[model samples]
Target: MGIRSVLSKPFAAFVVREQREWEQKAPDYQHKTLKNLVSKASNTVFGNDHGFKDIRTYDDFKKQVPVRDYEALKPYVEKMLTGQNDVLWPGKPAYFAKTSGTTSGTKYIPITKESIPNHINSARNAILNYVHETGNAKFLDGKLIFLSGSPVLDQKAGVNTGRLSGIVNHHVPGYLRTNQLPSYATNCMEDWEAKVDKIVEETIDQDMTLISGIPPWVQMYFDRIVEKRQMPVKDVFKNFSLFIYGGVNFEPYRQKLFDTIGKKVDSVETYPASEGFIAFQDKQDDPGLLLLANSGIFFEFIPADEYFNETPTRLSLDQVELNTNYALIINSNAGLWGYSIGDTVKFISKDPYKLLVTGRIKHFISAFGEHVIGEEVENAMKKTLESFPEADIVEFTVAPNVTPEKGLPRHEWYIEFSKMPADITAFKSSLDSSLQKLNSYYFDLISGNILEQLHIIPVKKNAFIDYMRSIGKLGGQNKLPRLSNDRKMAEELLKYKE
Candidate 1:
């Protein structure tokens, strides 16, 4: 390695050390501090304007404050947009992280100066934990590539602010920044159609060792690289060392990613949303991802199965139970309090508050009243993949097609493949059998004849992206809807004749 590379290692080590100290101190100190912060913010925003007199205890805060979604905070966002700060967190909003939410539609989530620290610190903890797990910080001295969203954000006044990627881009230590690619990928111009070309060109010859992004987008990049170079993915990514990702579960794409690389590389998972950066994989052996408890937020967990009608129980860091899934609720200093972000996670342990993301509670199939979660679906897919090692399924979606005339509801599978199955009939049969065996609900529904049939629709490699593009939704952050729970959306996807 060159002298520049040698010098970069110590700087990275210093960052890791600072991050470790922060992580160690956070869980212990955050709860009380965050409660105080929330109380102060509540007083500032709604003390006189609204009815909230005070928010002292956890129970007092929960009972007094009604849960607010993105739409509920529109006025606050509008205030910031107009260059005024009338809510929690002082100073003008730094950037709005664009998020594609399930119920709320596309949202421009406000990221203020107060909120930016959470994102930065959570990301730093993810890196520090990676180094701690591998016992090395200099595992990848080569170029670090982030397959991120468009760096530029379009503003109403025609003066564009930087996107989250651009903000992070500016913050990265100048010494470590790579010259292999442009400071910013310009091809992601005003139009979304131009982004793929830019992404493809920038990633082609770069000797990238570390890559970070959502799995689907990264897979698309690899596919494009393969097509352009006319070479196997192994040749394109021979120097790659670490695969860091967030925004979605990696289990579905695990086999494909491994196959493309031709070997195993360290994989890291991050639990982050436009709302805030939450947790990250702390130890390689442990299934639980460590929560960034200290970052200007008070974390709370409500039982995953808890309904809106029922009074939800919120667990503090010390009170959280092991092995039970919970819907994450946050009361952050950045303005959101007792907010239901919609994602569900299960605790692996609570001594240090390690968690495993189960899935979005909204994303599930309940055709015959059999609530099939993301974990069950993931396991079922893994079992089916294990049975058919020869098949290369790229992306898949499941929909519950209820036929009242037939007196049953069945699951219809839409799958995209890089290579066609030689024994298509047998593959389908095996998948059905595996799913039935894995999930008791599936088995009972099939055995009881409530689920009449399983239909598999095969599509071209890029069919899903084409579908997404047709809807004017295509980018790094956007994903092909996994389990279309909406009846119309599910029906439309299932009845896709093409």
Candidate 2:
């Protein structure tokens, strides 16, 4: 083993031990964190406006600060952009994480000096946790690559600004700098397809062992590698053992990714956002992600079913129950107060607070009160795939077909398939049946004849990819939504329908 590898084992052990200590005291740590955040930011503009000085308990904090989405918080953000200090948190923000917004054009989430460590260290600890558990520090000795946005950043109000991935690229620790791959120049390429080609050229001949990115992008890299090398990715990178991914659920792409790899490898699932790194898979065998409770964010949960209600009940970490879907709310050290990042999660285990990212709050189909979520669709597809071994998908999205030219209202499934199933009718039937079983509201709607059995629209190969490119969101942290309530996406997708 090299010097770094020899040192990593002990370092990993220390980090894991520290994490375990905090994990056990999560509730207490969370309470202290909230108190500290409120105390520190009380004199800042946001804290003053929200009555943070008077907050003595969770109830006080909740009463003072109502949950806010980006739109609600935009006024303060606008002020920040005007070079205002102590607007959100005390002093100027260290960086602004630029991300695409749906209603609002582009969102610039602040990354404060105090909060950057939470982002950097959580990612590091995830790998360290893996090393500590599996005794696999050998990957550190080989080249590693993160398929990310151009590290080259722009300035907004004299503060460095760019995509979260790009901003994070600047903070990659010194130890891993020598092992990180694709070169700085290659990563700065704005064209994602061209960047992937350059990345393949750079890493194809190297000793790459650890690869990280969103699943679809990583799959594209693998496909390109296979095409160029005329061999599976596993054969090309023999020591490649760890596949780290975040931003989207991996279940839908898992079968196709492994098939392309020609072998299974250890994988780590992470829940990262421009707002913060929320959770990551701690155990290889475990199903859910370990929530970073003690990390600089204090979490609250609003019941997903009641999220649209006038007065939704918000629960603290200790108050959350297992298997119930809740919209995640956060009050972070980064100066975000009661911010909803739009993600919905379900706690599978409460003792250590491990949860599954069930879906998004806005990304659901409730056209006819069916209220089907991302998790239901993903799970249904995953289960349906088990019976159709020959069928594999590239990308897919669900939308409600309220007014079809010739049929009753239905949920439209626009799918891009790598390999079509032998029995198209059977595959559609299985997918529909699986969805109905998973969502009782949808089942009831189907039985009542309010909505017809879901219709599958097989899209032409590379249709989704082409669509993403058209929108200028082909790669990096961008993700294709699995579900949409309206037909905007579905209508555009019909142009590519097979």
Candidate 3:
């Protein structure tokens, strides 16, 4: 018997056991999670102010902790940044996951000792669940390459601060360290081009069976290897059978990614943010990820339409309905108190409460009355691409061309393609039609002659890559923005093509 045959039994038991247990206790899991989180964080400053000692139920907890966005809780975070104790959690946070903010520079999210285990466990469980479902553990005997942030981290307010991927690397168990590629020395190189070159040089010959990374950056790695070896990925990594990805919608990049593989491979999507690891694709056939209902996060949903209202309606798991879009609110062990993480999701199933991350609340193109979200834009692009099987989109972004000087107000698409369609005008019309069908406001605006036809600007190849590299967001957890309300990014990208 192989090493996988020996290790698979126990791994399957741990993963499947938790999944089934949560499924069995789905309805009451929220209550249990809330009680544990509230009881644990009751002595902190927030707890004292909110009277957490008397808070016994979800209703009481809700009343005590009014749903807040990051701006509302900035005071507490500011104090914590100055090395204050027990500002949000029991002690100072162990690490801060600094992500790009919606309007400004950076937002520091706490990652505490209690919170790290939950993140690590969820990630571990995701892979284990896959192994249990497929009965394919031979990959375990080979290398697992995680294209991630730099190993070198920066210190902020005496606490370690870095991207989530970098922070995660520090905690990888000692046993797995032997099979991991691109050593710590290589990871320390801050320049993305240098790191990718080193990673390809190091991993091209290794028995890499599994890989994990965001799609675009991973695509860069595949291109490099193929260019170097003058062969497909299947030829170079014979045992490669699994690829895991997250941090952006994978629909547009799916075809390009699979083209590099040269053979079929299984993939799973995860909904992990600096706030917490929210969901994972547990089963092979299911499209929606099963929410981590039993995790420390207490989930709440506000109907997307009412999200910007003075006082929006909040719904619990029982209160949420299938097929409804919501702004996700999370209160977790990381001490985020009823914090709206600014992401939107839709429930596809209500039994065990399965969901799909739909879009970011800030990441929308609402030039007119139509609020075109990330999911809408992505789905529209997917539909348009179906008509042209010969073409594949490498990267694309949509923004408003509002200047009267440019003729009329309309959404402008900046797209980079691996294979350009023969009929460019038809491609643009089809994309605009698909979008109009998805959003009524967009359709009405066009029909009423209030807006001009959507414009498609075919950008030079590698424009997105050059832009990301220029901005120092070419690797790790960073992603290119897909939809913007303004023309800043679109204008900057036009300069590249010109």
Candidate 4:
């Protein structure tokens, strides 16, 4: 083992031990985090507006500050963009993570000096935790490539601004900098396709070990590497073992990704967002990510079923129940108070507070009052894939076909397949049946003739890729919506129908 790997084991052990202690005391950490955030921002515009000074308890904080999505919070952000100080956070933000917004077009999420370590350290700890658990730190000696956005920042109100991934690039530690791949010049290329081509050239013959990114973009990079090397990615990077990813559910892309790599490797899934680094898969055996409760962010859970209610019940960490889906809200040091990041999660284990990202609060198909979530569809795909081993998925999305020209309106699944199922008809039946079993409402809708069985539309290869490209969201923290309530995306996808 290299010197770094030898030293890493002890450090990793220390980190793991520390993390366990905090995990057990997360409720205490969360209470303290809330108190700190409220106290620090008490003099700021948002704190004053929300009566933060009088917020003595979780109930008081909830009453004083309502849950607000990006649009709802944009006025304060606007003031900040115009060079206003202490608008949301105590001082001017150190940087702004520019993200594609839903209703607001473009969003600038603040990253304060206090909150930046939560993003950086959480990622580092995830790697260290992996090393601690598996006793495999040899990957540290090899090149680690994080397929991310350009590391270019723009000046906005005297603050550095860029994509979250790009902003993070600047903060990469010096030790890992030597082992990091895809030269800075290559990473700075804005065009994703061109950037991937350059990255393939730069790292094709390197001692690459750890590869990290959103699964789809990482798949694209693997495809390019295979095409260039004329071998599987595993063969090209024989030392490669760790695959770290976040941004979306990895289940749908799991089979295809391993197939392309030619073998299974240890992978870590994280829950890093522009808002904060919320969670990471701490245990190799557990599917749930351990919530980062002490990471400068106070969390609140609004039951997903009641999220659309006029006044959804918001519960603190101690009040959450196991196996119940909840919309995640945050009051963070970054000046976001009761901010809804749009994600929904489910607690699988409360002992150390481990949870799974179920889906998004806004991303669901409920046309006929059947709320089909991302987790259910992903689970259906995973189960169906097991039954049909030959089939491999490239990318897919689901949307409601509310105004079909034929009989009943239905859920349309636009899938781009790498290998089509041998019996497409049976595959469709199996997928639909799996989903129906997981969601009773969907099953009832189909049985009661309120909606037709889900229809699968196999689009041309790279259809989703092309669609994202057309919309200027081809790369860098842009996630394709898993499902939409409306038919806008479904209608647009028909052009690529095979």
lDDT of each: 0.69, 0.93, 0.87, 0.93
Once superposed on the true structure, which residue ranges of model 2 sit more than 4 Å away at CA?
Answer: none
Which number leads on lDDT? 2
Q: Is candidate 3 or candidate 4 better by lDDT?
A: 4
Write down the TM-score for model 1.
0.88
Question: Clash pairs of candidate 4?
Answer: none
Candidate 3 steric clashes: 0
Pairs that collide in candidate 1 are: none
Q: Write the per-residue lDDT of candidate 1 for residues 347-448, one digit (tens) a residue.
A: 786566678888776788876777777776777777877777877778888887776455556787788876657788887787778778767888888889
Candidate 4 lDDT over residue span 1-498, tens digit each: 888889999999998888988899999999998999899999999988989899899889888999989999999999999999999998899999999877899899999999999999999999999999999999999999999998899999999999999999999999899889889999999999999899999999999999999999999999999988889999999999999999999999998899899999999999999999999998889999999998999999999999889999999999999999999999898988889999999999999999999999999989888999989888998899899999999988999887788989888899998999999999999998999999999999989998888899999998998999989989777889988898888888999999
Looking at model 3, which ten-residue stretch has the lowest summed lDDT?
1-10
Candidate 1 global CA lDDT score: 0.69
TM-score of 4: 0.99
The root-mean-square deviation over C-alpha atoms between each candidate and the true structure, in angstroms, is 3.1, 0.8, 1.6, 0.9
Clashes of each: 0, 0, 0, 0
Candidate 3 wrong stretches, greater than 4 Å = 1-5, 404-407
Candidate 3 Cα RMSD (Å):
1.6
Which candidate would rank higher by lDDT, 1 or 4? 4
Candidate 4 Cα errors over 4 Å, as ranges? none
